[model samples]
Target: MEKSGENYKVISCGDVASLGRVVLHDALALTGAEVSINELPAGVSVPFVHAHKNNEEVYVVLSGKGFLFIDGEEFAIQEGDAFRIDPKGERCMKADDTSAIRFICVQAKANSLEGFTQSDGVLSETKPSWL
Candidate 1:
């Protein structure tokens, strides 16, 4: 839970496997949406390349270098960059050279542990096996 008198949650960042030190600034509860700030090191990649059935997302780079893959199309991204992905828009990202990449991630709605899935390069909604 977040502390009072604050609208942000500062998530401690560090080496997450291949991903380097990164902070997850979660603002989902505050904004009533899935909005977050992430500080990623270079040579790191996000967890998956999937989409949300009932949520939309966006990423804005604060620093470092990387590429944004949206629907299989790659685009060069750098500091002070922004991109938005609609609901169920396939997406993923990878940092280059352990470059410090700070970006904002927003989700329209929170999924109950069962995030969307990708099958045969296609995204679809499914129940989480753990549920």
Candidate 2:
């Protein structure tokens, strides 16, 4: 499901607990980043390791247990764990044999962030509707 207005859009990604990946770039008409919600069942690993040519990736584990293999090093990951990988870092993920894993991966051009919330946000005279 989706809804849109002049400058905002919202989409519902029902039941991320299931196994699969849902890419939101095209769905949300994203211009600067690609985001995906992914789920892997127990004892499964991505078929191949991969690295991006220009974009770095950040992964936020939403549930369960997993391991991230990056540049031949393995790191344990579980709910609330987040990590960033450089553009050229070889990476793959596997869910532990005991449970499924779900995560959100966000990719954007490496070194492209010049300003974040504190520096970029501007106070507005307009108040939020609920206020």
Clashing pairs in 1: 34-107, 42-98, 42-99, 43-98
Off by over 4 Å in 2: none
Clashing pairs in 2: none
Residue 98 Cα positional deviation in candidate 1, in Å, after optimal superposition:
5.4
- CA lDDT, every prediction? 0.66, 0.93
Which 10-residue span in candidate 1 carries the lowest summed lDDT?
A: 20-29
TM-score attained by model 2: 0.94
Deviation of model 2 at 3, angstroms: 0.9
Clashes of each: 4, 0
**Model 1 agreement with the true structure over 1-131: per-residue lDDT tens digits:** 33444544544334443444333434223444555557566677787889878776767776788878889899878988877787767888888775757776766553433434453366448768985
Task: Flag regions of model 1 displaced more than 4 Å.
Answer: 1-28, 109-131
Q: Cα RMSD (Å) per model?
A: 13.9, 1.2
lDDT of 2 by residue, 58-86 (tens): 99999999899999999789999999999
CA lDDT of 82 in candidate 1? 77
Q: What lDDT score goes with residue 12 in model 2?
A: 90
